[model samples]
Target: MSDVTPDQLPALPVTFRPGRTRTVLLAAGTALFLVITLIALLLEHLSPGERISFVFTAALLAGVLFLLARPKVVADEAGVTVVNIVSRRRLEWAEILQVHLRPGDPWVFLDLSDGTSMPALGIQPGIAKRQAIADARTLRALAEERSTAGPGAARG
Candidate 1:
């Protein structure tokens, strides 16, 4: 993804998700699970119950990977939805006070009207730093355009 300038915002209902990180995690997890399951099924030395247990354990590990791959930010006309590892939060345009992605931070954060900050793991600056910065600016622009109440209403 390229940098999104304030002058040319993308269409509404845009989604921001980590590009490489999510894919890598999901793929690795699936491969590992499959290898483990194959081993369990092919190893005749292990009892039937043991095979079941092994598959079950693999499934649990995959579930955890799915959790890690779950985070994303969806921005629509009305508001934005932030989905993290274990939580999902919805905020109206006005409810988002600001969007921040300072250096050294893991991901984008929304400073909410409630005085609490919420992490947006979807826009992480790990392997894709430029994309994440661009996404952060795009989200900030959206918030500012949606809720221009007063000064500092949508600072990035």
Candidate 2:
């Protein structure tokens, strides 16, 4: 066991912002699933078993996909966590090489030491520009601070 005091660690920055694309997709998918299920239920020509199976399968698949498509971003003084619609990746502040705010880019990206880039789920294309920029700035600042502080200064 290691003796580490919480105060010795820098506080984590609040970096999460809701993803508009995800919210819109989830809403549309849910609506479609419900409408299809209702139609399958009302149509009499379809076999009872087939109708039930189709509706259940469609609803289940849509729900799962929608859940998976939800994007999330988390940042602590120690690192940043990005979870995309299909994938998730994390980078410690020390590993972050750069944070850029590209005007037309769909999302914020973190350049890593290995020359690979990871998307920041906090800024979604469909969101308001001002809000996205604000969150981006906050994330960038936190990453910069941690980077200058050096590795092992803050561990999570």
Candidate 3:
């Protein structure tokens, strides 16, 4: 398939915008946290001895909400990029080994050549119809291209 020029294959469509569910949850959480923090601050004004504890708790909660709501995916010609909320690692296409479309899996995954795996940017099959199938096909084609480009092409 390496011989098949890039132009021959349909361009890889960018799948998955940042997780909307997570984004919404993050927004809600932030709003709640802010309200709570403001209440805590007002209480602190009345009770100075307890202010430090309330402030610390509010800061911690805000931090967690920020991490959870952070942008997770951005796709372009270079490849898909993923950012996990807590650990915040970014992965690129060159790191991917294979893409699988399994019945039970909620989203597509990039099986790394090193035996590790990362979830695809936003290719969730559970949500749509034609789009999901088309995305899966695109991913499979990309995987085939990578395999053919790898060392095993001669044996096959």
TM-score of 1: 0.92
lDDT per prediction?
0.88, 0.70, 0.58
Clashes of each: 0, 0, 1
lDDT of 3 by residue, 1-156 (tens): 233344565655454433555566578777767777687777735576576666677768777776655534444555556655545445455655566657777666767757877775356554464465566566555545545355223321
Candidate 2 lDDT over 112-147, as tens digits, reads: 878787787667555567777766666666665568
Compute each candidate's TM-score over C-alphas. 0.92, 0.75, 0.58
Off by over 4 Å in 1: 1-6, 148-156
**Top candidate when judged by TM-score against the true structure:** 1
Candidate 2, position 154, lDDT: 44
- Candidate 3: how many backbone clashes? 1
Better-scoring candidate (lDDT), 1 or 3: 1
